[model samples]
Target chain A: MKLLSGEIISNEKCGKGLYKIEVFSPYICRNANAGQFVNVKCSPDGILDPLLRRPFSIYNVEKEYNVFSILYLEKGKGTKFLSDLKKGSNLNFAGPLGSSISIGDRSKNFLLVGGGIGIAPLYFLARTLIQKGKNIFFAAGFKDNNFIEWSGELTRLGINYRIFTEDGSWGDEGLATDFVKENIKKYKNYKIYCCGPRDMLISMQDILAGKKISVTALLEERMACGVGVCRGCAVKIKDGNGSFVYKTVCKDGPAFDLMEVIFD
Target chain B: MIEGSGINLSVNLGRIKLKNPVVTCSGTFSSGLEYSEFYDVSILGAVTTKSFSFVSRAGNPPPRIWETTCGMLNSIGLQNEGIDFFIKNHLPKIKSLGAKIILSIFGDDPGEFKKIAREVKKVESSLLAVELNLSCPNVKEGGIAFSSMPAEVEKITEAVCKILEIPLIVKLSPNSDSIIESAIRAKCGGAEAVSIINSIVGTAIDIDTFKPRLGNVTGGMSGPAIKPIALAKVYFLAKADILPIIGMGGIYDWRDAVEFLVAGASAVGVGTANFVDYEAGKKIIEGIRNYLSKKGINDINKIIGKAIC
Candidate 1:
């Protein structure tokens, strides 16, 4: 992966404690994929306030304009600094990390399950899969109307989607996992991809436990080196040897089979 | 003459000499493979492999690392694939990268350190030196860090130094009041040089979870936050006129590296910067070269101990 700097096109506050930072980088626009991520230097050049780079999933890519964007929640010092970035300021980051996911030519039906800000990568995945003439259905759960603008963006792309919120202020008054549980039989032949909070992903894993459907999870963890070096961001995975081995989310996967992943 | 041009950046650390005074800290760079993807590993003086043991270890549980204000804490517990796997598989690959490798070894006891040292002696031709890691604060195998006890430090050093032909550098910690004493003991035990400051023992608590942030409860703290403390220890050893020192802690840029050199460090180790920028060593090397040349200095050795000398 290349460490390059791009001019910040925009850093907009999309919702409560949420930001969408778009940057102009042809390298990322050309090299990055749907399921990959970029580790951003949250602080200014030479400033190490937040020592490690923050990992953000690729929310969108506009190859035509040589730009890419990441959806972030301003939970810490890093994203707060990112949210304050002015237009034309240089943003440094290491890119196209982890294994990139793509769609199978024969697989026509695809379902995306996302929870809260976890919808970032799935949006990029859905946008790419739709271009391949695949039938896509998105079911996402949120805490509030934080994703109302995101739903508009999805509709603009003509993607079929369903939304769930705990407050019933959006689409349905329930959790996304509940929706998937009731409709699991209908999505029997559809390939499933999910990204969300740990409990939500775990709930989905339990819902599809005995089912034959293929499911891949997009995982996020606090990381130092976004490459394979540090051995810091580890997740338990079935190693085919009965027990499990700690696989780094930065390298081995930000994406893995829901069945192979063992959640504590 | 143009400033920063044609200046020598090399230094001799006791019995061994480095083309430059920059080395990656043990447990930070991990055999220099992942970082090699970003920049040439050979650019730095040497790449210190993550500490290895006689047997492979999976290490402590997650979350193994947590970022603080200007530093981070890690309890990796020296998770490595054993010395044999490194020598047979990793050494040749890193050697091919043209980077000088310093094998870092740690053990639960003196015997374990000697076993790893014996293995290093077998592959001495491939390594520049052997660094005995006596400062790891994560594991509790010995009920305490070897660095905290000067006697155990000497005992371990004496046993491992007996089996090694290459220069030995003991990596000491600043966890106790007897760090200089431990360094003296290391020097007495046959070590040619000392790597000042392994990470300090520190812990962080999550306010939300109301528990310790690290799964290991406490981990070794490293990065820019620890530089001042590291510089003092380096100066302490340098002032004591013991073994040559490889000073490291919180060194992020060339200015910090220069500070360590001025404080009497024969060499500087870049630890946490490699996490923020994979090519931090390469940039620091270039920066040092520029600093030396711009200041009208012709050799890096001329600046060693410049402040206190």
Candidate 2:
């Protein structure tokens, strides 16, 4: 479906410049999977000033309540408009888009890593794995205490998570990268998923090189026509033939192997 | 034939005909594959494909899109899987959908355009017309857009017309030095119609990092912001009374479409609106019908050049 409307259940500030909006959309709850996204129209009804729809990863989907949540930072005009939307107002979007995650080797435990707003999609992944009777450990890192309240989301969801912030204001004082490095031996065999800042993803790519662990990174880019047509969110992938071809992050993946992605 | 409205919405581009006057811009609607998931694309007058080529193409790198106040800047460097891929994959699907198609093709030069037009000639029976894409701003082919030069426009149009049995429509640019000359030249080259205007050349800068937002540093701007400029261009060519004009640029709804028609456009192209609402085309089609019914105008052709008169 191209345009789906959802009513805002709650839109609240979670931390410094961070927001978590829950929307009531039975269609999305039934259709969307972890790692997919919804492209939202940020402006008010009949307003095309903010002309493009913003793509946000499906942060969490609560099937029981027929609701999905999005965690975003007040980054730009679009996010600002989204943040200002009042509760019970209708939001229009086109979604359940992008590639769904292919959770491989269920027998292996799950290791989820997130940085900043990248934690949004990981929450849904953790929730899905937990429901599937999998053992998952979520390791998240933030710049400061920016995502302080977001940590509460994991706690409320009963996810086993370790928090790391640079300022030590929120959790353990260190980088999530360092934590992953410190705990690599213990979780090397675990199925891993990471989403975060590009710098962090680059670092994760470097750290996980030749570790023989399955890792998927959710990528975000400035995109138009959240479907494959526009070729806006194209990323180079190392095809099996050792050469690279341009693959759209929207269609081929917002989820791809950390090793296969050539992030320039 | 238009349901109960008693309005004759059917229109003629040239030797060919369309059930309605609304079409999708090349590169924006993706030959109607994705949009077909939302509505029956047969409702459209025609579907113009993204720029066709003799060989497949890979578009620009990431950060190809940047949003502005009332529009967007995109540098999607015409990525497509060539004509062979389109014929084997998209053409059959479009045929199945039972919608008229216009093949919009681009080339590095007139010779290359002639080559693609020859291939198009093989499938001309399936297409309503051929659209020559002479003014895409993103690619660095020959260092600038071909439509910028009037002589090149006439030369390319004439070359393609020789091979194509179907009517030819020349797609022009707002960034051209003088689109009037280009349109006149296209008419001289035996083109049956012209689609104006392609995205205007523009740029957006990231304030945080103080760097260019698009990976290509510049892109073509489209949306409601360019509507007035498009209206002026369409009005000009229609007054020139050369060939039929297909006007487009930020047409969002039926009102925008009607504005283009009143300004002397025989048809309108829906571009950026497809990205905003999947049902934009459907709504515009319905809206045009309702508008015609309400105004007591029995024929859509009656509205063309009304503003110019």
Candidate 3:
């Protein structure tokens, strides 16, 4: 991946607390895939407190305009700087850097599960799957109604959607796991795709075990080189000899068979 | 006479031929993959990859790194995809970047080192050299710091040398009390080159919370603060003339790169500075060129060992 000087084409609040930043980086946009991320060099000289680059998944690619949009939560310094960016600010970024989810046989029904910010990537995947004429089933978990901004996007795409919250303020009062267990037969013919906190993915893997479901999960790990050069993103897998083996998330995957990963 | 033209900035480390004396230290900036989209990887003398191990590691939990003045401390936990996966997947990608790939290997035991080295050597076409990480104390066994014990260092390096035909750079740990002895042991163990002063063992505590700043509790300190110590080691080790020294510590600019050269190093490695700016290597290269032009140096070879009295 190459680092490009991206001008902020647009920064708008898409829904709720999330902001959509459309950065115009011709170099990155040309090579950027759906699930990969860019390490944004936030400030010009560098940022204070949080000095390292922030990682963001590529939200969407506007090829004709040579721009790629990143959706992020403005919680820390890196995102804070990113949010306050003027219209023409330039960001030093590297990208098309991680593994994307595998989209196979569009004719089969697909079940997607995403938790909190994890929904960012599933949105991209959802768009891709819909383009291929797949019947999509979605289960999204958020804290409350304030985080349900993505509902409109799903409705627009004509996707079958369900929302779960820890509190009963919106959707169901239980977790996504509850919703899946309650509605397993509905997704029996579909492949399951998941992205979220580690526990959520692990839970999904457990509930779907021994079923006809094929599960692929997107994992998040702290990374140094979005490329495979740094092993910082390695995840443990079960070895053939009933031992443990390691795989890199950046190259080998951000996507892997749910059964292959040995989650802690 | 041109101001900097007379200086020779070229040095040979084992089989790898570098255009200049500056190199990037491992675990910093990483290879072309990090900024491959924005920066030119070929402009640097060479790229040292982050340390890798035999197993895939998630590394230490978040809050893995902290930035200090002019440098940083990281407890990356020796995270890496196992050697098998690296050779199968990453080698071709790294080779495509055109920079000399210095494979950094770390493990818990000498046998693991041999395994990684053997597999890496099997794909010698993609790698220029193998750098054994012996300094990290985070792992339960086989840290690069194994060289702290002269005999063990010799034994480990020897074992690695036996399996690989490519040049071997024994990355020395600064945690040792006597770095010279470690260097000597590495050479005796069949190492063709040595990289001095992997981050010194250091710690950072938050004032408000009064606790360790990194998730790993302690970390290897890198950047300008460790340069003097690194320079001293390079200076003394280069005296042996048995192996080339890849000197690095706190090297943020070309002038700093030149210091390692003047201190008797054939090449230098850039760390910490790589994170501060994406074009750090190119800027340093330009600065070195300007220094050479000012000194009236045409061939970089003359600069090696120029500091000798």
Best by TM-score: 2
**Can you write out model 3's per-residue Cα lDDT over B81-122, one digit (the tens) per residue?**
577777777667767877777888887778888777767777
DockQ of each: 0.78, 0.77, 0.19
Clashes of each: 4, 0, 40
Off by over 4 Å in 1: B1-4, B142-144
List the TM values for chain B, per candidate. 0.96, 0.98, 0.92
- Which is better, 1 or 3, measured by lDDT? 1
| Best lDDT among the predictions, by candidate number | 1
**How much lDDT does each candidate structure score?**
0.89, 0.88, 0.74
- Summarize candidate 3's per-residue lDDT along A36-89 as a digit string, tens digits: 777777655532334456678787776788888887787766677888887787
**Model 1 chain A worst lDDT run, 10 consecutive residues:** A148-157
Candidate 1 C-alpha lDDT tens digits along A60-160: 99999999999889998888898889998999899989888867797889999999999999999998998898999999999988878767788887888
Residue-level lDDT tens digits of model 1 in B1-309: 223467788789888789899999987899998889898998789999988899987788888998888999988777778989999989999999999989888899998888888788888988899998888888988424686789998999899878888988998888888888988899889998999788888999989989999989998899999999999988877888888999999999999999999999999999889999888999898898889878998988889998885
lDDT of 1: 0.89
Selected candidate, larger lDDT, 1 vs 2 = 1
TM-score of 2: 0.97
